[model samples]
Target: MNRQTKGVLLAAGGASLWGGSGAAAQYLFSTTDISTTWLVAVRLITAGILLTAISLAHAPQQVRALTHQRRNVGYLLAFAVLGMMNSQLSYFLAVKYSNAPTATVIQYLQPVIIIVWLAFAQRQWPRRIDCISIVIALIGTFYLVTGGRLNTLTLTPVALFWGLWCAVAAALYTLLPQSLLKRYDALAVCGLAMLVSGILLIPSLFTIPWPHLSSGDWWLVIYIIVGGTMLSYTMFLQSIRYISPSVTGILSAFEPLVATLLAVTLLGTRMTVAGVVGSLMILLTTFLQAIPMQKILNLLGLKHHY
Candidate 1:
């Protein structure tokens, strides 16, 4: 595959896994006594250990080098605490307060947040297509969340608060790992971040009551650690290597669509027609924003500018 194709695929794959994982987590929450705190802590720690081990076998020298450098270590620590930890913890907290739909839709605001930050930081406006995509995303998110009945959803203040926080955390999660990815294996970076994040969450885990689980629940927990946290994070960090964080954020919008589908299939939730259409728009906007202009033009038999 071409570079752009690979990048988009990686992002989409990662986002899909994340969406499925969220659905799985929602299942656990409804059926078990697992606190979000324990879930987050264990996921980070376990994912961290496994990912780091794999990377160590694949690129031991680089992993060792990263540890030896104080500056790099500092960066990793910050990425872990501020980026990975904040994003994962805040997201689960949001879900704990509200349902998956509320949390996911609100956190989907990350793309807009990234876009605005980029615009301000670069002191320039986005292209017309970018603006159009953003507007579409906004409309789609609104429809998906509210289902055309603006007053149908009722959210507590805590839910609203954590939902917004997840937005900020999502933005950070996409943006913070770029430098690390440039200098180290993406797997190693994510693994270490997850490990550190787990350590940081250790105290919080103790405070929360641990949930009793059946054998099936343990299997589900394994899926969250391996498929959700490990695979999703590694692929996510990998995407930034070939695409901008803004585009990655947009592409990650696939999460909500997947989440909604899984919800309908497994949780017996109903999806309104407008909600489905809105989900499509959100996904379409992501690809519309992600596809390179040259690729689209070539497909249409147009001349290239350079």
Candidate 2:
């Protein structure tokens, strides 16, 4: 297969791993009494250790570079706090307050947030296709928030607020790494971010209880750290090496679809026809945004530029 094909597969695999994390986390929450803060702390610590070890093994030179770039280190620190810690914690809390499917759908808005951020940075309006996709995604999100019950679906204010925060955090996380990746290697970025996030969570370890967790809980934690945090990120970085970041971002929308399916199968969550339609619309919009119609036009020899 071509490099781009490998990249797309890696990205899709990463999305699948990420999708599985929601189910794992939901299962952990159901089985354990761990606080959100504590669970996040443990997750960061474990994921940090595993990722740091991987970086050291394969990219020791990148680790050395991190020591000299204090400014980059600071940026990574912020990235860990907001992107890793805050985003994860807020997402878990959203799942707790609302259902897994709702939280997952809300979290999928990150792409739209990134588009808005890019527009603001470039000081230009979004492309026509982007606008259309955004509209479709918003409609789907609205249906999801209402649980497909137009008249009776009311959201808890806290759930809505935290879900929005998750999207904002995800966008910030996505945008912050661009500058870093432009300057440093991917291993350095991932290592520093993981290290900093682990350190930031250290204080919470003491305040939150760290009692004995069950065997299943331990497995869930391991899955979160190894599969969700470390391997998934590794795949993401590797995929970005061969694919455009925009394409990778679009592929990430599949995470919600996977999560929603898992919620239905594992958590026994049900959805209405409107909800299903809305989800499809959002997914279609994400696809359109990723592979713009103009690109298709160019591919077909109908246009010179996209």
Candidate 3:
């Protein structure tokens, strides 16, 4: 297979696993008394150890080199607290308050958040297409939360808050890793970040009572840490080596698509027509942002130069 084909497959598989993990988390939230705090802590810690081990096996010298750098280590710790930890914690909290599908869809607003942040930081207006995307995101979010009804909300106020926070955290998660990713291996940086964040959360784990999970629940937990978090992250990162980041971003829509399907079918979650429309609109923004402007102009048959 061609590199692009392999990349597509890898990206899709990774996204699907991520989607499935969200559904699995919803199941645990619905059936058990597990707190997001404990679960996030354990997942990060365990996944960190396993991923770190793999990174060590593959490139022991690189991993050791990263630890010896003080400046990069400081950056890694900041990312651990403000990026990885916040993103994971807010995400599952959003899922708990809303559903996996809604939370996942809302989290896709990360691109929009990043765009806005960049515009402000650079002291420039967003491009016309970006402005359009922003408008679409607002309209879509309205319909998603209210389901076309102004007086009644489909999602609770708390759910909406956490969902928006999840988007912010996700944006931070993407942005804060740039420097580290450039200087060190992605897996090594991520593993160390996860380890630090998990360590920080360890005190909270003791504050909350341990959950009594069945054997089946334990299996789901393992899947979330291994298949969903570790393997999925590895696959998604690997795909970028074979394809453009834009292509990988576009393919990531599968995460929400799979999550929505699993939530609706397996969990019997109900979504209104307006809600579905809103979800599609929100997801469409990702494609719009991912597609290069030249390609979009070609599709529209506009030959004017930028």
- Candidate 1: global Cα-lDDT? 0.80
Choose the strongest candidate by lDDT.
3
List model 3 lDDT by residue over 280-303, tens digit each: 899989998888987768889997
What local lDDT does model 1 show for residue 219?
90
Regions of candidate 1 where Cα sits further than 4 Å from its true position: 1-15, 149-157, 232-254, 294-306
Per-residue lDDT over 1-306 for candidate 1, one digit per residue giving the tens place of the 0 to 100 score: 787777888888898888888888888888999988899999999898898899899999878877889988988988898889999988988877766655776776676678878888999897666677789878876676567677864456687688879989988987987887888877888888888899888897778888999999999898888888788877887888887766786778778878877887878766678767666776666566566776678889987531
TM-scores, all models, native as reference: 0.82, 0.88, 0.96
lDDT of 2: 0.77
lDDT of 2 by residue, 49-93 (tens): 777777778888777676677876777777878777778888888
The segments of candidate 2 whose C-alpha lies over 4 angstroms from its true place after superposition are 1-9, 148-151, 241-250, 301-306
**lDDT of all predictions, in order shown?**
0.80, 0.77, 0.92
Task: Give the 10-residue window scoring lowest on summed lDDT in candidate 2.
Answer: 146-155
- Candidate 3 global TM-score: 0.96
Candidate with the greatest TM-score versus the true structure: 3
